[model samples]
Target: MSHHTVSVELENKPGALVRISQLFARRGYNIQSLAVGPTERPGISRLTLRVDCSEHTIEQIEKQMHKLVNVLRVVELLPDESVERELALITVGAPPDRRAELIALGDVFGARVADIGREALTFEIVGRPEELDAFEELVRPHGVRELARTGRIGLRRPGPRQSRAQAALT
Candidate 1:
């Protein structure tokens, strides 16, 4: 199975998310990550979902999503044409002797130290999934106290011709 990312635009209603999730659940499709937020358009929200499934399964999932009520649009984000990011907050055991080293490692990944306590330091890192994975691996030996991640969010980069066409339309 290949990994797929899909962005869905839908009405901002109470049960919209539930219905969409149910569709996936009923189909036995596992969602690896999901992030939802309001869009610039009023009463509309965007959901970015990452799933591991076969190409045929993903096609079916998209078609099923289109049939759901309140769903405005569904688009598959091609990796080559998209920019993806995820946010992770990780707290690690930091003794005085290792504190500086931990800070330096975080610095290399452009991570910010969000909090520091007597025995721990929390870092906020925002980057692609692979970068976050590497950061986690490097810090695991220091004893991770806690970790939280905002699942992947992505946007497709429009081609130059598409950009020009959009500008002309506007």
Candidate 2:
């Protein structure tokens, strides 16, 4: 199975998200990551979803999504031509003796110390999924007390901005 990232634009109305999830459920497709937020345009929301499935399955999902009333557009964010990111917050048990060492490691990963307590240190990191994984590994030995990751969100590289006349010609 191949991993695919799908971007969807839908009306920001009640039950719109539920209906989309229901479509995936009925088809037995598992959503790996999902992010939904308001776009620059009001009354609309952009959804970024990551799924592991074959090419044919993704095509079928998109077609079914098109049949739904709320969905406006759906597009795939190809890895080669898109930028993807995820954010993670990690709280690690830090003894007084180990605080300095942990902070140093976090600096190496471009993580900032979000919070510091006598016994725990909370770090915030934003990067590609793999980078987050590496940071986790680096802190695992120190005892991770809590962790949260905002799943993959992505956008395609800007190809070009077309003027109204250019769009009409195309």
> Best-fitting candidate, measured by lDDT?
1
Cα-based lDDT for every prediction = 0.93, 0.91
Residues 21-122 of candidate 2: C-alpha lDDT, one tens digit per residue: 999999999999899998989999999999999999999989999988999999988776677889999999998999999999999989999999999999
Worst 10 residues of 1 by lDDT: 161-170
Query: In model 1, where do residues sit more than 4 Å from their true spots?
Result: 160-170
Return the clash pairs for model 1, or none: none
User: Mind giving the per-residue lDDT tens digits that candidate 1 earns over 1-170?
Assistant: 99999999999999999999999999999999999998989999999999999999999999999999899999998876677889999999998889999999999999999999999999999998989999999999999999999999987776623454544432
Provide the clashing-pair count of each candidate structure: 0, 0
Each candidate structure's TM-score, on Cα atoms with residue i matched to residue i, is 0.93, 0.90
Best by TM-score: 1
Candidate 2: stretches off by over 4 Å: 160-170
